[model samples]
Structures are given as C-alpha cells and as structure tokens.
Target: MAPGIIEMLIVGFAVGLTGALAPGPTLVAAINSTLKSGWKAGPLVTLGHAIAEIFMIVFILTGLYVFLGEYSLFVVIVGGIALIVFGALTTLDAKNASVDLSKSPDNAGNPVVAGIVTSASNPYFWIWWFTVGSALLLTAVSGGVIVFLAFIIGHWAADLGWFTLVSTGVHRGRFLLKQREYRILLTACGFFLIGFGIYFLISGMNL
Candidate 1:
C-alpha cells in the first residue's frame, strides 16, 4: 500500500508543525540556549536534540515491532528513577543557574553536551515512542520507509526552522544580560525542569 503524495504531505505537515510547535523539554532548552549562549549554542543544542530523536527513532523502529504492548515494568521503574534524579538535579541547579555573559564561546562541547543531556534525560521521549511515534511506524508498514523518512525529515526540518527563529529573535533582541537577571532566569528555568521531571516520574509511576 503505497502512500500517495497527498498522504505523505499530510503526515509530513502534521508531524513537522506539531512536533516543532509542541512545547517540551527541547523547546525550553533551545530558548534557554539562545538566551544564554546566543546563536551558536542554540543551534548546536538543537542538533543535539536531533541526535536524541535519531536514537529514539531507531530504537522504536527496531524493537517496537517485537515489544509492542508488552508491559515492561523494569523499563518503567528505571525511567521513573531517572525522572526523580533528573528532577532533583534540576532543583539543585536552579539555585546556581546563572550564565556568564563573558564566557568564551570557544567551548563548543558545552552546547552539544547541554543538548544531548537535555533531550536524553527527558522521559517524554518514551511516551512519544509508545504513542504517535508508534503510530507513525505502524503506518509506515503499509506506507513504506519512504513515508517514514519523509515524515522524519519534515519533522526535523521544522525543528531546525523553529529553533532558528527562536535563536534569531533572542540574538536580535540581545537577550543576553547582566549577571543578576541571568541568575534569576536560570533559576526559574531550573524550577521548570524540576517540575517537569516530577511530572514525568509521577506519570510513569501511574502507568
């Protein structure tokens, strides 16, 4: 069952727009990176997010065919533990979330590390794996890899576009600032991260 161009476009548009627009961990990271580190860090962080998504897509595509609907309490428990740890770390960091404006941009590794850690640590990836992600793969069974690839490409492009816009806006607005306000914003972000982590933990436990 080959997918028509219209079907491909629909999936592409739906996935791209929704995924790019959806407010989540990655979006927060992108916004924060732009505000703190400027354009260089923001895009690097976004690339890191893309890497995480690649890993997730690969994991889901390969294993889900066999693991679908098989409840893995162990995985759930592990994820829950991770969430609690992540939440705790975020809460602690909230107190020291200040970014140094004068910090050299030569440290390329920071953005990459930040992006990877931010995306990988997020538990929502697992939920997406089971829901819309799985559906995409299932649809691909009839629609073929072409459709899957198209959707993935579209989704990533949208992510790039969205983050670029955010980065541009932040840079143009000179979102960087003096030390005190920076610290406050960082603390606020940290609080949000902690809150998200706790929510993920609780949701995982309930499931």
Candidate 2:
C-alpha cells in the first residue's frame, strides 16, 4: 500500500532530518550565514538547498527514470537497506552528536549561494541521491505525482524547520539547543528513520 500523506510526510521529514544533521559543507554554510546574516540565513540557505535538490532531480530525470521505472523494486529495497544503515548510524552517533553554532572565520558568503555550492560539492549529497534518495523518490513517484510532491514538501519542511530553529537560536543566543537536547533529538530522528526503513522494506516486498 502506498503510504498515506501523513506517513509520507513523516518519512520525508525523518530521512531529510537524518541528512541535515550530519556534518557537512551545507551545515557549515548555514552556520556561517547565521553568524553573518542573522536568523534569516537558515531559511535563505534552505531555499538554495531546495533549488539544488530540484536541479539534481532534473538532471537525474534525463535518463535515470527510464531505468528506475524498470527496476523500482530493487531501488526500493536498496533504499530501505540504506535507510536502515543510516538510521542505525544516526542513533549510535546521537550520543556524541553536537551542533556547533560557533562562528568561524570571516567567510560568510551569500546564504543561498553557499547552500547550493556547499551541497553540490558535498560527496555525501551525491551518494545520498544516487543511493537512498533515488530509492525513496522512486517510491514516492510510484504513488503518483501528488505523493511525489508531498515527499518533496515534507523534505523541504524538515530542512526549513531545522535551519530556522538553528538560526533563531544562534542569532538570539549563539546556541539554539544545548548539547544534551540535540543528542536526544538526533536519537529520536534516528529511530524514526529505522521505522521508515522497515516500512519501505515491506512496501518493496509488496510491490
């Protein structure tokens, strides 16, 4: 059965949150922008990230969908496994995960541009698209365009939500969440990912 809209949203949020928490250039860009541009940097950076994701999907659509359409089950299974692995990692790492809102050097570029450039340049971003992202995206697409859009909306919401909180906290008080709270949040999201991974696994089997 295709996931309901709510389930899709949860899945997207969980998966996207898992990605956003990881240390990466985009995270750096977000932090730096927050330092230079204040709370607006988070949303602005997310807007750029959204653009980059769309651009990547467009690029993947050129010929990738042809193959994906044929081997969607395989893709879903792979995605499920990846999600499980990622979730496990997230859960384990949560114990030590820290959100650093510290100001770096004077290297604050345009928040939007930095989001695009940092994400595009990150190997983790490409690996995600090629592996886990493509799979969940295939599942979303199989459900029809509305579901696909829902997935994207949920994904973007996660990005916007997190960065917004980070920026708000950073701009107002240098750190939005304390280290312990951040770890707890990470652990919760990790478990959410694991659950979604299992859901995807079953969905693939049904297909």
Candidate that would win on TM-score? 2
Candidate 2's residue-wise lDDT over 53-162, tens digit each? 99877766665788777887788788889888888988999988887767582778899998899988888799888878888777777677888888889899989998
Residue-level lDDT of model 1, residues 1-207, one tens digit each, is 344545554555544444444446566666666666777656787789888777887877678755653543444444445434543554465455543233333433466676788778877666654554554444444466677777666667766766676566566864444446544544444454345345434544565
- Taking the candidates one at a time, how many backbone clashes does each contain? 0, 0
lDDT value for model 1: 0.57
| Model 2 pairs in collision | none
Give lDDT: candidate 2, residue 103: 58
TM-score of each: 0.57, 0.93
Q: How far is 39's C-alpha from truth in model 2 (Å)?
A: 0.8
Question: Candidate 2 at 114: error in angstroms?
Answer: 0.6
Worst 10 residues of 1 by lDDT: 99-108
Lowest-lDDT window of 10 residues in candidate 2? 1-10
Q: What overall lDDT, based on C-alpha atoms, would model 2 receive against the true structure?
A: 0.83
